[model samples]
Target: MLLALDLLGIFVFAISGGLVAVRNQLDIVGVVVLAMATGLGGGVIRDVLIGAVPPPALDDWRYLAVPAGAGLVTFLWHPAVERLERVMNVFDAAGLGMFCVAGALKAHDYGLGPAPAAALGMLTGIGGGVIRDLLAGRVPVVLRSGELYAIPALAGAAVAATGVELGVRPAVVVVPGAVLASGWRLLAFRKGWTAPAPRVSPPR
Candidate 1:
């Protein structure tokens, strides 16, 4: 079940990256590159950090297919895809949630402690978007002034990891934990919630 969610999350993030390429007026090659980057960027980083030699995405060719397929779909159905931007956040949130669980779990499996696992979970959640944005010549949204982006993923990862340590039904615990993170993201978006920036005055 966790594996399935991980795959689904990858697919969704790939589609989003592809859609972004479309929005950016990128060429076919650019779309494909962006799709793969956004989809696998975070997971690959997490795996490497956890010492999953060769990385699952690299070892399993299907991982490559998922993102490439997503990019193709975006290319073929651009108008329909464009219309789905509102729904994109929901999928993106889900992706964040799932990746957080997956990353933290992988870290724990590799014998990393709670602190590092939670941190890796946070990276696994947002690293892809950061790569995608950088490739597109824009600052990543998580780095920008936005609603609670990494926080939800962080919360979810921590919850899932703690559950794992407690011998909870990891599958059951993670699903709801992911959902919780997703809910937080969407709610933050809806509420226009954001962290406060420091006060600035006009230059003299």
Candidate 2:
């Protein structure tokens, strides 16, 4: 179940990266590179942080194949994919929810404390997007756009970590955490809710 969720998240994030590449007029190679990086980067970072060296994303062929396939599909049918931008955003929210919960669970399994596990989970959700934006030569949307992206990830991670700390079964814990994050993200999108931004004083 965990592996399945991870792969699903990878596919969604890969498509997002591929779309960014297309929008930037990148070639096939660039599209594929961005897709792979965006899909696998976060998990790889989490794995390394928790001493799960070699990262399943690097060791497993399935992980590599999923993102590569997503990249190719996006490269070939970008117009159709781009046409579904709003729908894709919905999927992206789901991916974020799953990724964060999964990350927190993995960290807990590795004996990390709840706080660190939750932090890693949030990172696992947003790290890939940050890498994609940087590679695409743009500020990461999570940092600049003030979208309710990372906060929901952190919230979901916190929920999962809290559940595990209370001795809950991982399978049971997954649903509510994921739902909370994804549901909140979808609502934020529909309602135009954003993170609070700093108020800059007008120049004299």
Best by lDDT: 2
Query: Compared to the true structure, candidate 1 yields what TM-score?
Result: 0.91
Q: Which candidate is the best by TM-score?
A: 2
Candidate 2 lDDT over 118-204, as tens digits, reads 999999999999999999999998898988999999999999999999999998899999999999999999999999999999999
Per-candidate Cα lDDT values, in order, are 0.86, 0.93
For model 2, the superposed segments whose C-alpha errors exceed 4 Å read none
Clashes of each: 0, 0
Model 2 vs. true fold: TM: 0.96
List model 1 lDDT by residue over 33-71, tens digit each: 899999999988898887797898988788899999988
Error of 1 at 34 (Å): 0.6
